[model samples]
Target: MVLNLGLLLRIPVAIGFLFFTIKASGQQRYFAEKPSISFFSDGLVEDITAANQKVTSIFDALNGEIAFLMNVKDFQFANKLMQTHFNEKYMESETYPKSSFQGKVTGFNANSSGTQQVKAVGKLTIHGVTREIDVPGTIEVNGGKLKLKAKFLVKLEDYKIVVPQVVWDKIAQQVEVTLDFAYRPL
Candidate 1:
């Protein structure tokens, strides 16, 4: 069979038009300027709190897609020994150096200029364990800037974080996690 010149010419034209349409849709991407995450655990013997400010995050305004990646060892604690234990024993940061979440935001409106309650449905991975979770949060858009805030609880058993028997009274079963991120257009 012989190739048709007219059909071959139309194929390239169709591909070009598809790319133009996608480009005209204006997919807005935002990058986090300073992302912060903190966790608190109240135990029988002691209360622990730690914060990490080196989290990286991205958001897509067009599709409501959001993602975050953070180093497990970046968390800072008031007690140095506790921090060491967190990285070595609980999180095993050497094996799983990074924790991440990838998901989409539900009920997000790009045109809204004020804070709106939204839910993120995604997979959260911690200590090498991945779980699908729905987290409630707020999105505030003001003066061309975007801010995200959320507070949620995490169960140690769910993430497979094993605590030593000796520190049973020092660690809690559930920990409260908080996130605050300010984003700028990319």
Candidate 2:
């Protein structure tokens, strides 16, 4: 009877250990969901400069999902007129609170070295319209951190965002967006 009890206890212990080992090994990726990403504009004459952008994504040693957020309030303007027009006419922040991108890393090879440019194909939803887009960007993995940088152009008309003729001269037709992020595995 004692032998049978000992065997039962050992069986449970072995099962528990295997379960934990599988769980630990299977969870190899980490993610952040509320990363801050932003865009900027310099009147209608000059190009915009976007900086200090943040992003939230899930990535392992292989691949993951990434989502971006754009705060309309973060945009700075040279004058109040441009700001008011953007808030009231363009973007319609009250109706559409945020813009987002959801996608996965395609053909990712984490072992790559130097400056490697990869194609990230994903769905971008802006102003409630979701569109599939392929963006070209560079991914550099150094130490244990991954750095990503990409620039893409978004058309206002595609998202049903209309720029009034009255303020047409004040806004650019196409907005240039830049995204830079540093990710660590969890």
Candidate 3:
């Protein structure tokens, strides 16, 4: 049932991502300082969440182009053990220290005020793996500043994150990811 649910959600998102990736290109760029990304996992045994506020991104307001960079080691969790395991075991932070996303926003307009619905299509790289994704989110422009937020799901196995058999039930197969990027014009 869970597998079916994921497939159902992924199809439309994939289609939208392809459309937006193509639509965003060649324009003036905007940049985000100290952007934030939060990762949440709800498992039968435990719910784990972590936030990284040291993210940096470059985005184009006119053409909808965007790119984000972050350090995996910078992600802070609720406890030290989880953080240690995530870095040394699951994420192999020593081996793969950085993660990034480079993409474009579809149908973006900086001049427009209020909140606008948009689709972001880009390549998200984590733990040395890069995958193409398209996700729906909202962008709010108030008095010239821009704010972008989105939430998406990622499968651990797809990124080659192998959990030990003993702790399989303690972890979730999918992780929910959220992003909050506040941009400043250059």
Candidate 4:
């Protein structure tokens, strides 16, 4: 009698647990479309005096594959040396071509409101090397959209990128990268 009642209660609880788990898993699999990401650089030394400003990288976020496309022609410099050296020696844009972050937003709430700080942990690939990085940023939901802003530092050595000795002083060992995203639900 007592044992039979316990078993009867346990069965329904187990079923309930399985139902919720399936629903949660389905929620995570849902995908967002066309999330945009952009990055800027301000580390050029000689170009500082020449009033050079460059905005690079406009990446698109798909379901799984994050595609980053940056036009080399978009970069501007005061002199030919800076342009040639940046593309060939420093960035090696021809060889590596692109940088990307493939990851998911954790604890994301589609109907969430106000300001929330979230941890975004994922693999960041740059210069042909991949590293696991956890970045903390605030997500603001207002007017039915998500606004995200985060700034983090990535070390050059972690990506096996060598800073030439001549301009070592000009570049910082760690590069500060910032991200600003405006996402709308699909």
Candidate 1 per-residue lDDT, tens place, 123-182, comes to: 899998999999999999998889999999999999999989998767898999998999
State TM-scores per candidate. Answer: 0.85, 0.70, 0.83, 0.61
Q: Could you give the candidate ranking by lDDT, starting with the highest? A: 1, 3, 2, 4
lDDT value, candidate 4, whole model: 0.52
Cα TM-score of candidate 3: 0.83
lDDT of 4 by residue, 1-186 (tens): 011212222244446335434543423122122233433444657322121122221111222222122343345556668667766886687887655565555655555688887767777777778798888887677876656667788787898878799888876666566666655433
* Residue 118 accuracy (lDDT) in model 4: 71
Per-residue C-alpha lDDT of model 3 across residues 1-186, encoded as one tens digit per residue:
011212222344446334433443443444565489999999787899999998866566765767777789999998989999989989999888888787778977776899999999988888888899999999898866788999999999878888889889989988999999987665
Which pairs of residues collide in model 2?
36-54
lDDT per prediction?
0.82, 0.60, 0.78, 0.52
Residue 123 lDDT (model 4): 70
Backbone-clash count (model 3) = 1
Give candidate 3's root-mean-square deviation (CA, Å).
10.2
Quality of model 2 by C-alpha lDDT? 0.60
Our tally of clashes for model 4 stands at: 0
Maximum-lDDT candidate: 1
Q: What is the C-alpha RMSD of each candidate to the true structure, in Å?
A: 10.1, 11.9, 10.2, 13.4
